[model samples]
Target: MNGRLLTGYVLRRLGQALVVLWGAITLSFLIVQLTPGDPARLMVMGGEGGDAGAANEEQLAQVRADMGLDQPVILQYLGYLGRVVTFDWGTAYSQQRQSVTDVIGQGIGSTLELGAVSLLLMTALGIVFALGSVLLPTAWLRSAFQGVTVIGIAVPSFVLAIALLQIFSFQLGWFPAFGADGLRSVLLPSITIALLGAGTLSQVFARSIREVSAEGYVEVARARGLSPAQVVLRHVLRNASLPVYTIVGMLVGGIVSGAAIIETIFGRPGIGNLYVEAVSARDFPLIQALIVLTGGIYVLVTLIVDLSYPLIDPRVVSPAARRTR
Candidate 1:
């Protein structure tokens, strides 16, 4: 019965995410089109609008028409929708001459690189801290650990990025703060992003562990004269860990988005920083495209987390006929 409900939940979530994707696409189109600047104009040049050039009105109008800018908005949307369905995104507005997929392809790897590396670091750190906090002896130490985690949650990523840059790049002369070429390049930025996740996940795991420790069955372990390690590793941590596991994917979405600000601060060529540049120039298609991609990714990640819930708790997979597929 629980299996049936879990299957149903996954399908429903997929359907809902599809709806959200559609809405996001539609809203993005409307917002970009309604905005004041000409997307084509924004796309033609680069570097802070230094040159509008001396193109005549005829040339400008011709450029617009050639790019299908003169077409009716609804018709254009239909055309764009058709291409998107076929997975054939055309050229980006900013990189007007470059294919949409090409532009995304060019930048996505870097963004993904940052996000993936950061998540790995964060997961390892968060889980370790959480487990340690649970098993550690001192109440004062636990309080201190939790306080540090809260501070991590409060500070902005950009601020962290700048400080790290100053320390590592300027003062220490350790890791090169910018270009993400290799493993060494990834270290500082990954650490910065991971810090945020570490704080949030650590608190979550700590709270869950503390709660699980208080459950009636945990007392059974205590009464049985089990060693503290045996009680925690064999009982408390397992149950406590289940809920915290769901947070892993949700945080992936955040790490990906947060990487943008962090990447830009350090002048990395990751997609997030590219997006920052794209938005400032009002590169509508690029902005819209990135938004769609990011939103889709977040939706997919959340859906995975939701489906994984039953693995955490059978109660999440209620046996109600209404809940089941």
Candidate 2:
């Protein structure tokens, strides 16, 4: 809680983040090398369906040299680490003279927008579902709320996306089937992503609320003649919300990773769509960069959530901080 403790906690998390990043980079590099066939040849062939015999030895050798694939593996890895740190993600092998950064930039905005909208919807739906399950007067109403959450969790996102498209876009005609033209186009895909997270959070949150409601303080508040709403708002909500923060942080990473499938299903342009293209084309550089980008996002969100715990619940203490005392 003090300045010194906060500094040490932050430093520790940063160290852990660096380790995770290193692992992601190493994994990406290994994936490129372990794939069948020569990367240089693949690059020269211009990805899948290109004429394999069209590129001669000279072109293959040049591609290898240009990619630093001619160097020793250890040296190449070291150089790659340096490039990643410097944000020089190299060129897209499948695209003519386009940098990997530029290729990613083209779709990053769409992904971010989708992620943001989905996150908000996830939060709102989760809170509503959690509160309804716990606070609704009728037992049947509570069961219905719980049933919705179960369905949301059980259904595969891709299946749900297709079903939504069929009903909303094809039959009802309330929204577009696909594309990222306007806010309307965003609605279906965002809902597809949000439902999964909301379902998960609602279950976790409802459980937390039940546990918090039984605490002695809550009993005391209710004993003081405060109404149900007053007791819940004043005594139960804040403590119950602590677990929700952690769950929400984890959901952020899931949202990012899930974007690929959801984007592909909805015919939306996003990092996920770009990732599929990169893989299909055997564009190692672009694929490597995207892997790191997603990994970094996961690590960053987790670190932020860890740091926020002390602010949310001042009673929280890191093991390191506790040991120091």
What lDDT would each prediction earn against the true structure? 0.76, 0.87
Candidate 2 stretches with Cα past 4 Å from truth are 46-48, 318-325
Q: lDDT per residue, candidate 2, 273-293, as tens digits?
A: 988888888888889999999
Question: In model 1, which runs have C-alpha deviations exceeding 4 angstroms?
Answer: 1-3, 42-73, 319-325
**Clashing residue pairs, backbone N/CA/C < 3 A, model 2:** none
Roughly what TM-score does model 2 have, to 2 decimal places? 0.93
Residue 164's lDDT within candidate 1 is 86
TM-score of each: 0.86, 0.93
Candidate 1 global lDDT: 0.76
Question: Which stretch of 10 consecutive residues in model 2 shows the poorest summed lDDT?
Answer: 316-325
